[model samples]
Target: MATPARTTQAATTRPVRYAPHLYNDDLAPVRKRTWGTYSIFALWMADTHAISNYTFAAGLFVLGLAAWQVFLALLVGITIVYIGMNLMGHAGHRTGVPFPVLARVSFGVYGANIPALIRAIIAIAWYGIQTWLASVALVVLAVQVFPGLSPHTTNDVLGLSTLGWAAFGFMWLVQLLILSRGMETIRKVQDWATGPLVWIIMLFLAGWLLIKAGFDISLTDSLTDLPASEQWRQSIAAVGLTIATFMTLILNYGDFARFTKSHRAYRRGNLLGLPLNFSLFALASVLTTAGAIAVFGEAITEPVEIVARIDNPWVTLVGAITFIVATVGINIVANFVSPAYDLANLAPKYLNFKRGGLISAVLAVLVMPWELYSNPVVVNYFLGGLAAFLAPLVAILLVDYYLVRRGHIVVDDLFTDETSAAYYYRRGFNPIALQAFLPAAVVSGVLALVPAFSAVAPFSWVLGVGIAGGIYYWRSGRVRTGPLPNEVIACASSSSTPTGSTPAPS
Candidate 1:
């Protein structure tokens, strides 16, 4: 685990090339700023490339869209993810801190806890879901590795069969061991896992389809397989859902962005990481999924399943090993690490990053992850609900940072609980921020839950963002305002570029 580091004076005084918001008393800034656009590109490989992700993307077939329309929908949806990632990237680059500490800025010194916990809870839920999904591959791999284990598949207990329990435990223990080592280990492991996973899957997809479909199919097959009615529904839903899915992560991205050497580095990383990386992965995913249909005579959404269809033992073995590694990368980054920072943010005094993350990882086993994935319908509902939480927070932050503060932040005042500090808003919590969050979240939650609102409910995130921003502007008045200290000013002046209220130039 990364031990905390002190804030260097040069961090804020220079051209703000360093991570600003992330440097707290307890956590040190990442000493080496070695990650670049390509690292970020690989990071997305880890983020978006996964067994669950392929399932989710191809699940668009349920929306009744043809494969081509589904592809178009995916393109539109992920493009939004691209833009959202860019916005989130700014926070990371400007602050040089992780997510939880940076929340102190927009959420209020104490008020930040609410958003942090919200994000943490969402991360925990996903941790369970991702773990459950990865267990699918684990079970497949186990049965292949040790064929005698198959008899245990039917032995049911506590909803899951004995084999299911073993697989879940296998994934659980592996994640625990990986996570306990801390962020550095996670980063290096992620870089290694995602690259090979992609290569093997691409190879598997080509060879599988060439054997069955005679390599006659193209990536555009998904476009041709669409159902007019369902495809349209899913296409639009995918757009909104994609935005909602990635939007909250966008707001809290400073959790990692605080590590960059320059804002330029962050921007370069995001551009490579999001749109370009996401789109290409999505395309490969759909093609393989379609190829699975031709090869196996059943529509296979899971990549592990597609590889399992291979006849060669060595090919299947390579696919099995890569699947395990890929799921590890996705689960930790998208789930484990995020919740760790979130819970730590909630009670910085009681739970630092490692403890917070540990609590989340341990609790995941207790959730009976199998129950979480028992019904995909139930899973989507939870995702929609979690998407509701970020709206109000996003609205308040955008309004306060851009319209109110005009993209400036005071570093020291953020840490100090002193009455004189800029961030210590009366009694160390900002009611205005709270006011924005409650109503927006409640309404969005209801919209997401109710069947009547299904059409627009996928848009719950955007609705929440809009509602929060408008409410903050409407209610905004008479709050004290002033320029931050010389240090903040120095950072701001140095990073200045011609722009509007971006709050982040780099």
Candidate 2:
């Protein structure tokens, strides 16, 4: 008889032979779910303690609301994200597949590409934006350290300056090198870049600013006070924007959840990582910027600008490097990884993670994100538009997995185009799901873009989810064909092991 070790090895290796059109090592179900609670916690630590988040959080305080009101709004928004992440993460933990593959359960194998491409486009845009944000720090440092380089910052080629291009290219190359080593390397980078260093830096910045301001700062002081109705409206808008900031991650959370060891671990990780951690970081941002108003005679939302004003090279250098590292951590985890999996899902036979990631990076440069980032109107439009697009997709996937399918997935069928396969709907497209998603997305999109409906733009995600999920649930009940009874099911219960076809962690 074969030894148990050999038998286990055979079981794990066998699934690698799934259809070439869907079977690449990067796109395959992960064999080992090794990421633990701390890794999950660190993932959020990396995501939140970045320059963009700092600016975003700081911007919230000036929206004609008290600090406590902003916090309350953020609490509401973040709680929603925590719940959405858990719901989105469950299918990945059970099936050990990425977002694209998990999407195949509801969208047929070929039609899954629609959501995948949509997500990829969003990631690519943000990747460029974050890269541009990080490069700004480099420009600040370069001008400070080498005064002669200050002129190079002004001669704009296209939209960015000569120095801006150099800094952006350098940051891009650093990210590419880290990504070339794959997920483990990215996780390791996140662990180191974020954990304590970022928190320490944030705290130090807040403390120093408070000292410079003689501890005289107020969170209620707004640039322009508005009527109570306007205050409430903007506060609600703040909540919506906070939720919008996370819609991309909320939709494709399986990209991280697939690495988690158990459903319990995934929940524990998201609990610590999202609401609690994010709240503290938001507090730090508000405190630091409020102190800046007292000291600088004007409110400065940019941390790099605050750091630049201090007459200390060592402080500036450390701040720049830490911010850059923190920004890079989030960029790779949130932006780079999503598109890599998404693009690979488009053509698994021709592309894997590295190649897909490379394609994303190339597209990042072509988008000229600096122009997009500089315009406030464009940024808001971008956020509202993408949130509308993402919300429907997220709703469909969550409803199909937990309610409709009852937490069961025929993992093998997700890879096959066989006529009899459970997921292989007409020409590899699920008409019911498509019917539900299209109308909902279109309505949400139109509402966000139309000037008359501008008041509802911030709540686009809510609108899309309600419309899409409601329609899909009703349509799914009417449909005769669903999951085949005889196929292998990845057990959804927390207590039971997944089917034996899923390889156990070695």
Candidate 3:
């Protein structure tokens, strides 16, 4: 008989694969596929069916454009969103990892911290802002239910009333409770929250517009006065801004896409979630905002305010629930999940998923996000600046993945301590990515911020992403990627030595 193969001794032999403990198995990919086309469809509903989204739809007319121009802007803007989502989804599906882990490619074993922090900070800020916006609805609901609350609302400080604080705190508690559970709970919650809002908003818009049509407020009234030149300029800006806004979601999308079963599943989800879903929601929002204006005698920018003024308690309640759901959906996805992964990235050894997210939530309150709520212009400017910074990061990552490695990474090496890990270029960090990104990002930032160059602000994200991608590709294209799963760092005593390793104890 052939001699029995000697089993590798545990003490003498290293493991063949490095498991990325970047996340708990709770997030591990499951073979049973769950999210279908409808669920994917509902995701964008939750994102776009909110109060802010409705206002944005109606406000597009403020660009002094015809209704057709507004529609064109919305379509082009959302199309870009569709494309960006797919681009990021590929990475999410490939390694079964989220944004922060995928970030390790561009940011490095340790350097991923920079992008992680940037993404986390932005998510927390938006979370607080969205939470506060949703709280306004709660405030209206409280006044509706308890007329006595009218008396406690008088004291105003720093652009918010005492009732606003009370409402915000209550909403904050509600969010904390939802987040107390893991992300699976959030996925289910979002599924339930979006559909009804879309239906109600659509029905409401149709009902109002029908009445307006009977009174002869034809579409022509809305279309005839728009100047083509101004409309085109605004529409172009709108398209770019919409793409940039969606790009932010793309940057951290692996956070959600990690749950996908296959690349096909990822693409299916993107098609349903982005293009189809966003298009319908944007149409509904625009119609409702316009119809509300015709019916109410003045434009109502807030969904809660529009619903509140209605005499039908049932209709108002439906609107209230819808807005609440939409707000919660964005809050969990954009705010809660992102910061959690980001903080976890920072201290994989220290903070687990839930605690890292909770820490972010708490600090968000301390930041007094209410300060940011007072000015929409300020918020837009800040968001624009952030997009400029992040676009470069995404560019570098995409170029590195697609062109440099030809869309391959040794996933196992993500957890390795080996000196020659495929990812361990110059001590677990890639300086060339940084070198390319910093200059491109800075240029984009200046363009966004400086008033004279602000006309091109809408294009900053694309410009930054492109420049960084090209620069990084130029620098690192010559380096050969190591073979096998990214986890296979060479043995500490292997031929290829990591340059930046701490010298063996002097």
Candidate 4:
């Protein structure tokens, strides 16, 4: 892990004057960089080792492709994600800014809130759904271990059963406690619980399934029965969907990458985390699904369902609790942390990290995500809608940072509301970027919603990104620039705030 840089008294003699809307300790550049390669690795482990990821991998097997074909597609898709993340991580690692603040360099100072709120809303939805999923696992375990409790499971309250409410409320409180402690606690939980323990349970679960199936599992059995043309087409589409799964993280990776010690450390961590870790996870998921099919004569995509089917009480209990813990780790890293920073970025003066997190948690409940997840049509619509906005936003950021500005961000100017600041374009809005985003987003949304274009929906993120990025690059004249200017370098050297600020009293 990276060590904290010592703060010189000169750097902190008096805090720099900052606009009320633009500056807070939480939104400031990190002074003491502490995350290293393993933290990044563990982040991916936490994000990917959940019920949703497992189901996504198992769903790929049903796409009529051979196992080798699926693996190849995964490799290609993940490599693209790896490249995109490295590009996004550069700004954060160098400047010590979160995603939304980094976005101001491209979107303009106040305009950054548009992308920030959009990403935060998406995080809120997923946060509720993942917490609900963990609660469902708890419900399953409760029913199995104590059959007498089953009688009380169906008493309805607020669209959830009595027992469902109990489990959901419990998980909700637990997440709040974790979030209350802040990011360091989240990092430690993920680094320790998610990386090793969850993998062990998953391996054990896969082994049990294989043994139960007489060790005759085969991922390609169903695919071999399909026509060649269908297999090839579905394989390509599956790769697109796989890429879409990580689109949210790809856009906001700077939220975590900002804590890294260096760009080299960031890249090394992603190399191990994205392609390598994902491949191993996909393999295990496929094996587990094949085993389920061999034993039960039907594919079981959900790990919770697979655990519940086991007759051994002890095994079922362990699997259920492990999955609950895994979901919490993922929820904290992927959902909680992103919005905590994103929402805090929206109103820096009043809402610090903890208050922002509390707001996200409350909104998660208000959104009634349980109803959304229960309906397949609603889930698809929600995810498709998110893709439309997210894709264009990511494209705009990449184009502005890389091609337009030549990766030269004046860090101090990012927080200043001064009319002369480079980022204060047209009262804190970039017309060129908005022009690029709106049309591309409309086209992507149409492709996602229209049945005639449904086949193209899987690649909606790719299409939006490419279209918006190309348009922005064409409209914004390319400017070649070198390292930070002397003034910007001096500002960076002189500001020495702590990494994560102590939350304001609630």
TM-score of each: 0.86, 0.91, 0.87, 0.91
* 275-318 per-residue lDDT for model 1 (tens digits): 66666666667666666767667667777666766777777888
- Residue 169, model 2: lDDT of 97
Pairs in clash, predicted candidate 2: none
Can you write out model 4's per-residue Cα lDDT over 333-417, one digit (the tens) per residue?
8788889988898888788889999999999999887898989998888877777778888899987777766665556667777
Best by TM-score: 4
- State each model's CA lDDT, in order: 0.67, 0.81, 0.68, 0.79
Best by lDDT: 2
For model 2, residues 125-221, the per-residue Cα lDDT tens digits are: 9999999988988888788789999989988899999999999999999999999899888888787776567888788889998898888777666
Residue pair clashes in candidate 3:
107-112, 410-485, 410-486, 411-486, 412-487, 413-486, 413-487, 421-489
List candidate 2 stretches off by more than 4 Å: 1-17, 218-225, 374-378, 478-483, 491-506
* Each prediction's RMSD to truth: 5.2, 4.8, 7.5, 5.7
Ranking by lDDT: 2, 4, 3, 1
Candidates sorted on TM-score, descending = 4, 2, 3, 1
Off by over 4 Å in 1: 1-32, 61-68, 160-163, 218-233, 375-377, 478-506
